[model samples]
Target: MTKTVAHIEKVLEVANSTSAAALSRLAASWRRSAERHGLDPGEHRGPRRLEGTHLCERLGAFEKLMTVAAPRLDNLYSLVGQSGCAVLLTDDDGVVLDQRISAADTAVFEAWGLCVGADWSERHEGTNGIGTCLAEQRRVIIHRDEHFYARNTAMSCIDAPIYGAEGQIMAALDVSSARADQTEAFNRLIGAQVAQTARAIEEANFRAAFEKARIVVAESDDAEAATLLAVDDHDLIIGATREARRVFGFDPLGALAPRPANDVLGRADGPTGFEKAERAAVIRALTRAGGNVSEAARQLGIGRATLYRRMKRLGLDQT
Candidate 1:
């Protein structure tokens, strides 16, 4: 029996015997590919590609992501390109929007349906790197014969999902290698870099989304997770990254309700009352006037004597 046929029989044997929930991630993906997606492990057809006009439309929709991901893609490819790897960025639906590949390997990747506009979603391409990562919403590495389709068993794929500003899965960053000499240890190392690059792209897009707001990193046990919040001048939380939203108990997909930064961060808001408000207002005016009592009084719309009396009553004289 041929190797491809033997691989197909093995895949079918495991897929039919084990329930998806009872299997490992790889086996679960295999089960989904064979049963849910209705894909044959022996199928030899290439991946589906979007036509010119449709691909153009998808590219337009992903303009911001492509822009932010360009430098990241270049940097990742620079690290892995010499290893006969191709770096690709795909939209949320798994359509390749951008890629970086060396001239010598272009024909090889193109022949394997790793070109721009190719669909790599699990439903279409089965359990491969980009598709499975999107489906599982996490970083994944599919090496060689681990691939669901026999034709795709020659390539190794490492992928990470890129989350959007609103904490949605917006894109995927992938590094794929067709070299027969690729090893699992090397794949793990490259997988870490791919995940980090994906996080950088997510942060850049998040900062761009809230350009005018102050970006603050939320304290978390998982430092590797991107836990960020965007606060406006008024000290209201205007935006949050996916990890931050989960960390702070904010609505993941709904619009932020503009909660006080102190309240969300669990910090003390200090004294609250008319006296405190008056004290704060007077102090702000005094600071803004460079501690000139006369100018401070003028700014506060009060007589100098009246301001002095209020400041003293508010315990400002002690300071």
Candidate 2:
């Protein structure tokens, strides 16, 4: 049997396996591709490409993301382009919005439907890197025969999901290579870079969304995912990253209700109180004034003597 026939048979065998618990992520994805997506592993048809007005509309929807991600895509390509890889950025629906590929590899990637306007969602393309990453909302590496489709088995893809400012997946960053000698270890290294670049794009988008808010990094066990919070001038948490929302119990979608930063961070203040707010205001004024009592009092629009008395009452140190 040819390699394609062998790969098709292998995919069918794994998809029909009964041991669901023991299946690896790739196996699970294969099963999903066969059962959920109803994809034919033996199919040799190329991916569908949106053209003309349809392509432009899809690109327009992700214009902001493409703008923020352009530089990142360039940098990632610089790192991996020499390896005969193509860098692609796709919207949440798996429509490729932007791509960077060396001229030498352009025809090859285009032939494989890795160009702009091509759809790579799991439902369309089976268990490939970009598709599966967006499907599972995580980073993924689909190397060679790990792809459900026999035709896609020659390429290796590394991808990471990029989350928008609202803590939802807005795009995916993918690097694909058709090199025959690519190894899993090398793919892992590329996967790390892809994941880091995706996070950088996510952070840039988040920062732009809350330009006036103070961005703080929250503690997280997963280094690949960013845990961030955006605080307003009043110390209210106005926004959070996906991981932060998951970790801190914030609403995963929609506008977040403003909560005191201290409360969310589990600091000393349990609830907002008049005294706490007043003390916080005084502390902020003092900090802004570089600990100068007169300047702080002026900023607070209170007499120095009154400010000192309030400080004393609030147990603030006046050195």
Which prediction has the highest TM-score against the true structure? Answer: 2
Q: What would the TM-score be for candidate 1 when compared with the true structure? A: 0.83
**Whole-model lDDT for model 2 versus the true structure?**
0.86
lDDT of 2 at 158: 94
After superposition, the stretches of candidate 1 with alpha carbons farther than 4 Å from their true spots are 19-21, 268-319
Instruction: Kindly give the number of clashing pairs for every candidate.
Output: 0, 0
Q: Please, what are the lDDT tens digits per residue for candidate 2 over residues 95-192?
A: 89999999998999999999999999999999999999999988899999889999898899999999988788889999999799999999999999
lDDT, candidate 2, at 160: 93
Cα deviation of 233, candidate 1, in Å: 1.4
**Model 1, span 180-275: residue lDDT tens:** 999999999999999999989999999888888757666567655677788665657899889888887888875677987656553245433324
Compared with the true structure, all predictions reach lDDT values of 0.87, 0.86
Worst 10 residues of 2 by lDDT: 266-275
Clashes of 1: 0
